[model samples]
Structures are given as structure tokens and as C-alpha cells.
Target: MVSGQLFNHKLLDVVFENANYGTIIIDNNGKIQYISNKYCEFLEVDREDLIGGYIVDFIENTRLHLVVQTGKSEMGDLQFLRGSFVITNRIPIFDDKEIIGAIGTIIFRDLDDWKKMNSHIKDLLARNNLYTPEVDQANGARYSLHDLIGNSHEMNELKERVKRVAGGDISVLIRGESGTGKEIIAQSIHQLSTRSTKPFVSVNCGSIPEHLIESELFGYEEGAFTGAKKGGKVGKFRSADGGTIFLDEIGDMPLHMQVKLLRVLQEREYEPVGSLQPKKVNVRVIAATNRPLEKMIENREFREDLYYRINAIQLVSPPLRERTEDIPLLIQHFFEKAKARIGKRVNSIHNDVYELFKKYSWPGNIRELENVMDAGVHLSNEEFLDIDALPEYIKRDSENIRRDSEKIQKKTLKELVEETEKEEIERTLKNCKFDKNKAAEALGISNSTIYEKIKKYGITE
Candidate 1:
């Protein structure tokens, strides 16, 4: 006989009957003992029709048979008969230690709903030009803050700083080596900020002609200059009025343009090159540069005042050589991305290929790394990548460095004495990570010797 609290038990059944998921219970004879109203609605059947039907008769997939036979719960994918909608979940109920009955539920996922959510997210990322064919491309070139992978303390600190600074309205100056993904970081900040819903305009300051820079930045009126369009083109600043404007290679910007740029930054308004009217725009500016602006200012190349204006919040990005540990993660990420795009079955990379990568100094940083990996994926004949598929430049440079070491090993007395002086300097540079001042102290050699050898070795850093 059933136990006490029959009324309370009925109230619980009423609550389960109203659930969104399709829930069912079957008896020892494989007949439906109890099925929720939601389950019948999913099956598009009346309650009376489903009450005595076999549970297996309705379940589309035979994979559910294991759960019924073994008295153990199991989950798998399934599709409904009417809508053909894809659903996934488990058989939930059991009668005893022996196989007797089961209950199952479904989770319906619509592709249209997923597409809508994905499109909305892409708009939030402020993706302008789609770089779909690039090695790092994922899901049609939508990048999130999480995609910026690096465990280096410097990278982590930079990410934390981006999160904090994204809320404020201050101008940011990102200083880093070229090909180090400065533009990516700029977009990430814009996407994470309150202005995510707004536009994000990226302009390569050095790419545009000096004469056209003014008009490109501030919109000109119709017929402002000779051969001007009938309808004035909107400037990047105006296009990014409520969002952000990324100025790349700002150090190469002409001095006259710098003066005008500084004025606009101070006043938040600018007259278009061809227009008499001044347009006001509320835009957050983020500038990036590979050159040393501080040295430029001292040499009277970059304006000191303009540097101070943009440098309100400075972010220094470390080069790839400084973060050698992140190479493996970058390789794996690019491999998966390439496989998805090219439909290749590449599953692994040679261990020696990674060792070679870590040994060489990447002058072009992450961008170069992506290019190298992409080329390897396309050119590789084997299922996994090997060193033979790498570019000639990388192979030649590494070969030259290794050959130089071998030459030092084989030398006569006079040659050994001559090389000993040079060897001492090279050893110090390696220990100091090529920092001249530290190398001088460690070698007990003069700073001038360190500088002289640096020129001889062709070390730029």
C-alpha cells in the first residue's frame, strides 16, 4: 500500500506536470505508468492515447534501449517526429535493482535561436572588416576578450587593467612592437566597455596620404575640394561619435597633423577639411605605436605636448620573445582554427618544431607566428606538421645562428684569443637577455664593448 500524505503527493505531481521539459515514467511491462502534460504536448498526443502506449514506440533513437534494459540512466541525442528538432538528454527513472522502468526528458535547441544570439554577439564585438581567412579566424572573425590567450604575468596584468579602464572615458596609448596585436586589444576594450553597442572605427594613421589625413579624420562638406563627392563623406571621428576610434601607427603621423590632432583632442570638436561648420563628437581615442615616442620627443621628432595628451593612460605590450612560454598555446589554437577552415585532419605538431620556435627570437611577434603556422598547415603533406614545412627565412636564420656556434668551437690559438674577447661579450648579453647595461655589469666589461658587439651581432632590441 502507498504511504501517508496523499494530498501532499498530489500537490507535488501538479508542480512536476507544469514543468517545461518533457518528462515520462514507464512501468515494468514497458507501458507508460505516468507521463507529464508537457511530455504529451512535445509528442503532440492526447494524455489518454499516451497512457497505455509503449515508451520505446515514441522514442526516436534506439540508443535509449540500453537505459531500459540495464536499469541504468543514460543520455544521448534525439529528434522529434513532427518538428524534426534536435534534442538531447537522459532516461531518468528506475523501479529497482533490476530493469523495470524509466523516465526521460528532452532539451530542445533551435538553430535560429542560436543564430540570433550569435549575430547579436558579433554586433557587440564591433567587427568591421571580417578577416575570415586569417589563421586565427574563428566563427567568422568574432573575437572576445577571452580569446586573448597568454598566462604571462604581464599579459594578465594588462587584461585586468583593460577591464578597469574600459569603464572610464580617458584616452589610452598602447605602446608595443609591430605585429603584437595592439589593434586586437583596442577592439577588446571597446567590446568590454559600456560603448559595446556603438561603433568602433579603426584608422591606420600612417597608411592614409598626408594630404587626405585631415578629410579622412573629419568629414568634409559636399564640394569642399576639387572632385569631392556630392554628399560629404562622414569622417571616422564622426562615425565613432559615441564609441571608440583606434589610431594605429600614430608615431608616423606628420607633425602638422599632430598639431591639429592635439587641438581636436583638447576641444572635442573639429572643422571638416571642406566645411565651414565645426562638428562635435564624443569619442574615446586609443592610439598604438611601435616606435619610441619618448626618444622621438627628445629628438624633436614627436611633439612633447601631443605625447602627454594621448599618454593619459599608457599600456606597454611585451614582445613575443619576452613571452616564449605562450608559444605552445598559440600553436594549438591556430592549428584547430586552420583545421576548421581548411577541412584538414591535422591533429598534432612535431615536438621539435616547437623547440625550434622557442629557440629563435620572433622579431614580428604573434602576427608572424600566425602567418608561419598558417603556411605550415596549408603546405604540410603529412597529417602533422614538421620542420621541413616552415618558411626559408626561419630555417636559414636558425641555421646561420647554429653554424656560428660550430665555427667558434673549431679555432686555432690566434683565432681563439681573438674570439675569446668576443665570446665573453656574447655570453654576458645572453645572460642579461641582451640588455646592454646589465650585460656590462655581469661581464665586468665596459658598456662600450657591449654596444660595439651589439652592432656586430646586429641586435636591434
Candidate 2:
């Protein structure tokens, strides 16, 4: 029995000395019974000085003795020793179901080891902090109803509809030609909704690549694919939980993605790419598109089911030419806005400039009007915006209208009135780029009236 005990002690001593980790063993009285050579090297102490000494005397913030007293184990606890951090595990040594001592093992041999294991984690956390606020701001609504800036009857009715719809949780579809402030209307609705305080995540479905749209909307797991982030990313849907998601250009979303989007809209849950678990989210969806979804559905470019799902409420934004009466108000609003931005004060605009603007059809809507005002504010040296301040395209268009008016002046009084009406009708049609429906709307006349005039005057594009 003595020889057997001697062999066991030899085996333990050999194992402790050759072990790759730093370890120490202490008796129930908290006196160190054994210290590995690796442990002594970690502390920069000699084995002679540490052996038989109380562990607390040599180690700062030591907890191994507490483990012996409590008869418990602490796994993966961080400890600061000799100005460096080490991850350690402490366990009570058992002998016949009674605690006789305690053993502490250090997982990292040194500070460098701990840093190597944690550097990637630290980087990922830093990136998350850096991206969080940016994500919030990018996803947040930047406009309200007051930003719509129009006083036409169509504008008034659209505003009223938006106000009524803002109080509900129904999905909305905003349809208009490009640059007609479709996004502005969508944002206005979101800001007035109960979910206004939460994130307003915006995604341009057409802007993202087709292959990557799924992952961008429903994030991927780490290592799920090549070049994935170290930690999985939160997708737009998850980020917009309990808030609104403004899907700009939703019509441009690919066919496959449309099916997935339809499912999310119906089920209110989605599984991230490469993840089996589905995440539930409460998000209000507001979609905008310039494309005619009905036409797209007919052509099989868009899904009919998805269209019906998203179009629970529909809002149409009238084009700028259709709201010609609002041009002066819009110009003054844009002029003032531009004055503040450019640090120039233009108190007045030439009447001819306004006439020119009225004559030119704004195909780009309010966005184009703002750009023109911005250019005029910067180019005008005088306090009034003149013809010279206009863009070259507008200037040429204005000259053509002036020449047409001059030719009308040479006719007889009754002939002059009829020619003036013809000129005005033709000009309006030309400004609307020969879209009969839009031209009728712009002229505040019925489509049938415009069609009759086109037939009577024999107007041809």
C-alpha cells in the first residue's frame, strides 16, 4: 500500500509539472500544497516561495480558498493577477465525498493568450456600437406631412387621406411618377403613426443587388456564406420591429423576393438566411413605387397576391404639372429654403420667370422645382431671380413659348381668342409631354374635353 501511494504521488507530480496550463492546489486550510512550474512562471515566482504558503498571500483577488470552504466550483471566471487578466476555473478537490483541498486552473497562460482569443470579439462589439446610431438615423423618418408643400385640391384630399390612414396599422402603397415625393408622403404617414418613436427602417428594394437582397432584408448567420461578418447581422425587418419599414421602390424587388415578402407580410415572421429559427416582428410596412403594379402584374413582372397584400391602402401623388396652381407657392417655399441653405437672400422673382416656370412642364415634379430654385438662388447676383438664372433647358423652352405668343397677336380679335385657346391647349399638352390624361388634369379640364379639343384642333405629337 505504501509503494502504491508513492507511485500515485509520483504520477501526479509528473503530470502537474509537464502540464500545458497554469495550476495550483491548496489544502483545506488554504495553504498551498502544490504549485505547477507553469503557474510559478505565470506569477514570476519561484516554486520554493509559493509552495506551502497561503494562496491569498501570493495571488491578488484569489478565490480558490472560497471554493474549498463552499465546496463549489467556479468555471471561466476572470481574474486580474500581476497587472494582467486571466480566465480561471476553481473547483473543490474531493476525497471520499468530503472536500480536502481546491484546485485552480488558468485557461490562458498569459495576457497575450487572452487578447488573442478576445480581439475579434472586441472588434465586432466596437463595430456594432459604431453602426447602431447610424442605422437608427438612416432608418428614421426625415419628413412630416407639412413637408408635402402643395395647396391644390388633389394635394388637400391626399393630405386628408394620409391623416386618416396615419392612425391605423394597415399597410400603405404610395403610387406616383418618379420624384413626386412618394417617399415624403410615406415618411409623413410614419411620423404620425403610433410607431413613430420606434425605428423607421427604409430599404430601397431596387438599390440592392438581386443575389444579396434576401440576406440584406433577412440577415445571415456568421460563416453562413463567404465574406459574412464575424457575428451575424440584424436585418432590416428585425431592426424595424415594433416600428415602420418604408420599402421604397418595392415594385423593383425580384420575383423570388416578392414571394418571401408576401409571406412575411402575411405571417409577421421570417427566418434569416441560413437560420432555422423564425423571428417574429411587429412592423408596419409602407411601400412606394413609381411603376404601375397593375401593369406589372398583367405582364407577370410582379405578383398579384403581394400587390393586394401591400395595397391595403393606396395613395396617389399628383404630378407637379397637374398642380399648376401650386407652382407659385412651391417656388416661394423652395426659394426661401434655398436662401437659407445658400446664405443668399432673394426677396423677389421676376414675373417673366414665374410665367416661364408655368409654361414649362415639370416632369420631375416638386423635386425638379426645388432644384431649379436652388440653382436660381445661387446664380442670381440681383435680389430678384431673372430669366438668366433659369436652367438652359427652361430658357430655350420659354423662348419657344414667347415666339408662339407673338404669332398669335397678328390675328383678328375673334381669331386671336380662338388661336390663343389653341395655343394654350397645345402648350399644356406639350408641357405634359403629350400624355392626354395628365394634360387634361393639368388644364383642370375633363379627359373627354381634352380628347375633343385634340380631335377638333387636329393636334398631333
Indicate which candidate wins on lDDT.
2
TM-score, prediction 1: 0.62
Q: Which number leads on TM-score?
A: 1
Q: Rate the local accuracy (lDDT) of all candidates.
A: 0.72, 0.81
TM-score for each candidate, following the candidate numbering: 0.62, 0.61
In the predicted model 2, the residue pairs found to clash are: none
Model 2: how far residue 124 lies from native, Å: 44
Q: Which stretches of candidate 1 lie over 4 Å from their true place?
A: 1-142, 401-461
lDDT of 1 by residue, 141-230 (tens): 234455666888878888777766665668999999998888878876676554555677888999999889988998788989898888
lDDT string, candidate 2, 245-267, tens digits = 99999989999999999989999
Q: Relative to the unseen true structure, what is the C-alpha lDDT of residue 184 in candidate 2, on a scale of 0 to 100? A: 82
How many Å off is the CA of 7 in candidate 2? 81
Provide the global lDDT of candidate 1 against the true structure. 0.72
